[model samples]
Target: MGQGRGAVMAELMFWEAVRRAHDEELSNDPMVLVMGEDVGVVGGTYKATLGLYDKYGEDRVIDTPISENGFTGLGIGASFIGARPIIEIMSVNFAWLAMDQIFNTAAKVRYMSGGQLEAPVVIRSPGGTAHQLGSQHSARMEKVFMGIAGLRVVTPSNPRQAYGLLKSAVRCNDPVFINEHELMYNMKGEVPEEDYFHPLEGSEIVRPGRDVTLFGYNISVHWCLQAAELLSRHHGIEAEVIDLYALSPLDRSGIRDSVTRTHRAVIVEEAEPMVGVGAEVMAIINEECFYELDAAPVRVSALNVPIPYNHSLEKTALPDANDVVEAVRSMFGV
Candidate 1:
């Protein structure tokens, strides 16, 4: 909110915020180090861990081989022994190879050990359909990771959260999964230069409105904001937008309060409709504010089909601002 690096609020690309987070954490904590494929010499697939290789050297900024499962297991093992490991899978598509370690080990170790073990590790991967990345490469694994029992899940919509949330995740003792959007690497947003850390749990009301609430996180959060502006300017419908950043330890109170006040909601997600954050938010609305609701909650989500490689087909597969606006308009019959 204030000045960054002696400048009047630093404007940074999403990857820069990510890189800053990794840089800060690695510098601040002796035990904090990075491990993943090409995270060393090549500077990560998305460059989210750039320069750390040079700054921290080989031991701290580790470069793992091609085995996702092996390195993921190694990272979790490192965390178990008190070293905070930040494992970056080049893509969520590749993370499937490490599911056994993520779900059975990292997510369950603390519980399985009866609190004797703390898997204080953070696994980050960029997911969702990005341009022509095919179905196999474009899986939004948030639904899968968020559903796990003992994991904390979060997705940041902008640079500030990317910086702040990663800092928080590093300090937290629980196993955390950060799902960054594949297409949001270059999206620019402001980040204060001051040392700031956003909470691991909670949602922020990005825009205040009276008509209906629009909910999203990561890239979908931008879609909600864009739709909210259109609804306000063209249709006179003021739509409140909520950034549901913490997907696992969901901010139920925030969701309840906004849905209670607005009485209608439209959830925008890049993931499929079935068993998603949309469905969970809708369930919460039905349970907490059923009588307050004037209309059924609507979910504007990607099609159930696998993400097509064709650009046009991919566009059709994902939800957009127009879909959100139309969904909100339908609630009020406007």
Candidate 2:
């Protein structure tokens, strides 16, 4: 069994890692059900639920109509009665329709019921601007979900994280929102075959450096990594890259610790700067490690306008690795 000790690691794509997590969790718990559009028979929109309907059967892997509010509420209500449901919103844009159930019902049920009730529902959605998917379908709404007090929000940057984080979220009693990037579905990385769980909260230092720290999450993490590489290869600057996978309850201590070490910080994000992940990370640095800064913190983010449909416009609207490199360069006067 993959659960056994010393299980070998395997390379898997982001979607396959997510599918593995769903399959394992469904097998581990009889009450774990997956519900979403095309989740059954048709699989999932991104193939995250491929073969799950056949493996687990229609009863466990359900396909709901294209009503985000209805199915999301149904999943939340199911969780209240001891059911562990993984609800997949085909696109994060449609999640706006289910805000009432997610924010009001799932997030507040435990508090409103005096701890007598809980909503252990997991809502996973693919978002981010992917090859000119247009503004409506390419919503990067992690900031919106992270603001809610009771929900756990996480965005995995790689397949290993994609595997472990989903497993951990399934076992967690709190409501979780996994914000996946649409462009990363086919990105392959090594995942441990052994059963393991990633921490629900904390930032990961993907690269260690002494000059400056670059903070990012999900797809932005890749940008930071690429920028860090370029900075080292060409500029002789060793920059640390931190992956803020958990958005809600952002790792204040980790952010402070990294900034204290590097003494300079740059946050990279695909979302617009105003009221975004970059803004929040900058706040954390300012509030917790203001004294440790060797320079003012910087943020590299997308334009304030909506994501465009024109290929060139979309490319121009979003921030990239070059943008991150330039942000750091400005700080160092490189």
Candidate 3:
């Protein structure tokens, strides 16, 4: 069931990918377990861990109290004792309660111990805006961890990348933060069952073109892909779309290669522009691909404001497919 090329094209939802990754890892490793609020009986808020408690039993699949800080600290302690705990934060909004454990402990334990101990912990959390989930729950906290040192930040855009990256994050010997977009849980795409692992450092080109390079990650990557298709069909401009799976370890090589080929670039991100991930990508392009650029690196991102409750206002605040198309057009003076 885990092999054969035919299994690669089987479409799976994002939550299904998470389920597959956890199930496979748990079955193989005795130390691997999952703990979070309502994860056991309730099958997780997003249903990512559904049916796990039945198969793995209560000891392996645990339901913690509504205490992010306490349970996260417990996970860190367990990791110190050689148990690889998959700590699921109910949402990135709740993760604030566990910042001390995440930043001060999970991120620094191995380095502080001088290679004597390893914290193979994976903290999975749902992040970003979805279905008008208020100001606190709708926030995109990728920048918070991006600033922290000694931690791996990954945000996969599609089911394939999500599955592969989650698998790799589970097997790694360091603290890994896997940010799954709340809106992307039901999004479906093909994932290989042949145990494929994409490196967590580099970027993947989703679409190849010559006119402009569109940089994206997480939900923005799928938006850029749609924008690329629109730009080709409606405006006759070919746009190269790059999905940056790993945000912290930015893929300079992939960005450089794409920018060198396309000469024009536009970075698209769901976060606000002022101090967001797009700003970092723009800086990298300016530093590394400055000579190759034919135009300034344009950034199409959410406006620098809190996401509104009104559907229309929220949609306007976030970068849409049209925003990407316009940004690409503006970059090329078209």
Position 22, candidate 1: lDDT:
95
Q: Give the C-alpha miss distance for residue 170 in model 3, angstroms.
A: 1.1
The TM-score of predicted model 2 comes to 0.97
Clashes of 1: 1
Candidate 1 residue pairs in clash (backbone atoms < 3 Å): 4-193
Q: Could you tell me every candidate's TM-score relative to the true structure?
A: 0.97, 0.97, 0.95
The alpha-carbon deviation from the true structure for residue 59 of candidate 3, after best TM-score superposition, in angstroms, is 1.3
- Candidate 2's clash total is 0
Give lDDT for model 3: 0.86
Kindly report which residue stretches of model 1 are placed more than 4 angstroms away from their true locations once superposed.
Answer: 1-8
Give the winner by lDDT: 2 or 3: 2
Q: Model 3 — which ten-residue stretch has the worst lDDT?
A: 1-10
Pairs clashing in candidate 2? none
Candidate 2 lDDT over residue span 142-226, tens digit each = 9999989899999999998888999999989999999999989999998888886888899899999999999999999999999
Instruction: Compose the digit string of candidate 1's lDDT tens values, residues 197-252.
Output: 87889899999999999999988999999999999999999989999999998888
Candidate 3: clashing pairs of residues = none
**In what order do the candidates fall by TM-score, top score first?**
2, 1, 3
Clashes found in each candidate (C-alpha, N, C closer than 3 A): 1, 0, 0
RMSD of each: 2.0, 1.8, 2.0
